[model samples]
Target: MIAVDPEEGRVRLSTAATEDRELWQFLKGLQKGEILSGTVASIESFGVFVALDDGPRHPVFSGVGFITFPELSWRRFEDPSEVVEVGQRVSCEFLQFDTRNGEARLSLRALQPDPFATFADDTEVGQTLSGRVTKLLPFGAFVQVADGIEGLVHLSELARTPVETPEEVVQVGDQVSIVVMEIDVERRRLLLSLRHA
Candidate 1:
């Protein structure tokens, strides 16, 4: 029980694991950054559910662990299936206990190496790198510099001549040379210039 109004004869019950002493204790004992192994039980548009190999079963869900789509991988993907599938065995870092949802929030990407950091370590401003235009927008074009790393070339940086759109200079899948303008490792972003290429 969490709250109650004696005069109104109303009571509010909590769904926290506190009601299940063993589960509550287990959840409390968990520390962030701990690795947890589990099997993918179900996949949803928002996240994936995992049936933990060690924890007690969830009262309502098929799994007691959950991983958000962004936590599944460092690479950009259109769907969760691109990163993981149901029944796949996975080792994820425990992010936190989702008290509201009664599940352990996990991150599969945390256990993997960050491609951006590696790219940044080897790259410097003004260094030219060969890349393929992966996407084009009105403001700029997105170029894939590495396997999972993409850099943006703003319209003003596309060329010396004024351009209205990225398509005026480059199109998707077009291999192009670009100079690194900025590598914001903290923000995990890269700004490039086709004009200086």
Candidate 2:
């Protein structure tokens, strides 16, 4: 559809060709939770861009697909390249259609079994586990007990003696013994206690 204003000499175009319509229809048919295959178009610090095999070009960007850091893989990785490379074929679960941006939010991890689910099923509260300190914050430290599972050891749980920060007692890459204080399975959060361990 094209509209013109003779007085202002302005024009607007709103129609698509048959192929464009078909492409859009195909994109529209995709639903959340559906798995789709695509090639890795590029990798950025923030996310990975995919060129979907049967999807339309983004109305804005060069690609119509995207996968954020957390959605890239089941395991924790510092870089996207560790899990996928440019030109690699991948299967991802469609998360949602970003109508405003004309892109699909996809998750590569959805195709894999959740490590947390398995961890929770086999573990119980008060279980002592050995872990490596992966990160430290003002309030707590994140300890990786399993390949992809991390638990938080709050400042209060760090030691029997009072401490101002986690760094006072533990640093990154330190092997620590921690007790599982609480588990919120629905939320996928694990609370650990270094003092109790």
Candidate 3:
């Protein structure tokens, strides 16, 4: 089979014998949000590549499917290999067709339940949770309340009095107790108050 993208000035050729009509129709039928299964073809520092079953072959790479680091798993990990390994089977949500690169943008994390949803269900505003400061920004500090879940403690909420920056009250890696001020479930954002805690 042969496919050409005139705008990109690229041509792709596949030697596998298959029904031309079926192949073309199958390629056209794929849509975003579809769940597909594939084997982990390779693991890279940036992402994991999957050779999807019943999917079109990629023109340049070994696999037609790719999952970025953030999409690999629900929990944060130091490396991609920590979440997936070569030859391991995985089901991923098809995020989009990377027409420019001719690969499917897959998300393995989508198949798993969101930790934020669970956290919100278990906790409410006015509750206090102990967390370590993961990042400090000019506006506020980010505290990890649970695995894969982080809340922002706004600068105004950091102290009883006005503060210039988050650094005045907290630093990265500092253990602090934070009170949940607001929980925006739709946005998946947790507004915390260090002063109230």
Candidate 4:
């Protein structure tokens, strides 16, 4: 078993309850939707491991939290260091948990309202937006305006200009300005267009 020591501010691994009480307290408070403040202990390909305020010399339990790629905070840094420095204090809300395994799925992105929600709040049918292609599928392309929001440009909407497949014109990472022809709230679909705009 891995044990951590948080007696002061230094972290080390020691199999002692008196030494690791801080981590235990932090872990105990992990409830769905609970926001916990932490420190970025280290980063990895899969995700970053945070040291909770609950404490310990070594990380409470290594490899406990994640910031799924899409949920990562935008940073100007050429690398992860530009935003979150090692030992930097960070706070995030829990998005999910795997009870079978003691892991917490967390998000730094959830702190703000979703851009899709903002788009719905600000616009209506006939409003226009400048969109950039993010993903290209066989059937259509996904265009995004603000971060975290995207609209699908189906093959049928690519034109009167269409010769057949979505790839004939739309390409991944292309910028196309489109109008919000329709927004289906119940289905979370946005009927987007370039030709219509």
Candidate 5:
């Protein structure tokens, strides 16, 4: 029984398909790091739903597999479609069984190499590199230094002069030269500075 209300003589029994034997059987068969193939069932602002080729149909969701936006790819994208389209076949790494959502959390990026790791392996602090501005915020601007790699240039580092916003120095898509101020592999962060360039 999922819920009960004795005074009202009402009971919510386990009718959800996720509570069925098939779901448990599918989940039990899943192991983290295992590859799963599926078709993209739907794409939402939050994530993409995948219809696993081997799993039972989901109880409530459109598919039994789910991939969050970040897991879609290592590269940044403005829309989910930029990474995948509905009905497209894809292979993903099974992250875990998401009990709350009754779906398996999957990652498409896990099947690809991490560009940040390669960038860190070859790059160093004080190295000057050119990048295109990708986003502007009150605190900083994000610049794409390499494929699937971005670094933050804080407001203070945008210019030698005090600036109110990143727009004061750069705009989205502007090519700018920057110096590597820090590369924190532990935190997976890369800090850049235009002023020091």
Candidate 6:
């Protein structure tokens, strides 16, 4: 089931298990921290199962792995299956090894560099950064400062004009200028505003 192509990011699973024994042997050969590609076989309440894409037809899977539901605030896809379907291909970073059970802990979200880490290296409070609005919520909008890093401009900080819903003053996909008010490294939260602009 596992497959690999030059254009794809990592490992991928394009078919069902044709040789479970050989696939099992290949899965045992992989080491931790390896990047993998695969297809969505099935999703359960606990996690997602993916079949590998290389010869020998291995079975590699990824779990939500870190954090809980309330912390993510993901607005959509109440179920993991809703977001990743039965045939969709995915890429993940191998994190933990569990040879005893043949299950490895994988991460899809943490694959890329952390945004806060980069922002902290190059930015400071009172600085202004131009960014695009990625998501809108009642509290604020999430602005993408880089590929994975985002800053939030609260409703009260959107503008000097009276505020109601975050969307009323700012809409998603609008590129705006924002002043960095506070950089809470401990919390990984950036406080931003457009009032001065």
lDDT of each: 0.89, 0.85, 0.84, 0.66, 0.90, 0.64
Q: Give each model a TM-score.
A: 0.89, 0.82, 0.76, 0.65, 0.84, 0.52
Which candidate leads in TM-score?
1
lDDT per residue for candidate 6 within 1-197, as digits (tens), equals 13455686676654333334654466567777787776766665556666656523333434212222222222224567545677787777666644433554566655655657777889988898898998998888988766557788988888898788888877889999998888887788878888865
Candidate 1: stretches off by over 4 Å = 1-19
Q: Is candidate 5 or candidate 6 better by lDDT?
A: 5
Query: What would the per-residue lDDT of candidate 1 be over residues 83-132, giving only the tens digit for each residue?
Result: 99899999999999877667899999999999999999999999999999
lDDT, candidate 4, 1-197, per-residue tens? 33334576554533543345554454556787878677877775545666656534443345466565555563212455554666877788887653433446677767755656666788798888897888777778788866656788887788777657777887878888888888876665677887787
* CA-only RMSD, every prediction: 5.9, 7.0, 5.3, 7.8, 5.3, 10.4
Give the lDDT of residue 3 in candidate 6: 43
Q: What is the descending lDDT order?
A: 5, 1, 2, 3, 4, 6
Kindly provide the TM-score of model 1 when superposed on the true structure, using C-alpha atoms: 0.89
Residue 1 error, candidate 3, Å: 19
- Candidate 4 ranges beyond 4 A from true positions: 1-26, 56-66, 70-85, 95-99, 171-175, 184-189
Q: Least lDDT summed over 10 consecutive residues: which range in candidate 6?
A: 64-73
Better of 2 and 5 by TM-score: 5
Q: What's the true lDDT of residue 185 in model 3? A: 82
Model 6 steric clash total: 11
Question: Model 4 lDDT vs. the true structure?
Answer: 0.66
Q: Among all windows of ten consecutive residues in candidate 5, which has the lowest summed lDDT?
A: 11-20
Residue-by-residue lDDT tens digits, candidate 3, 58-141? 544667788999898877788788888899999999998655455678999999998989999999899999999999999999
Give the candidate number with the greatest lDDT.
5
> What ranges in model 3 sit over 4 Å off?
1-25, 43-47, 76-79
The TM-score of candidate 6 is 0.52
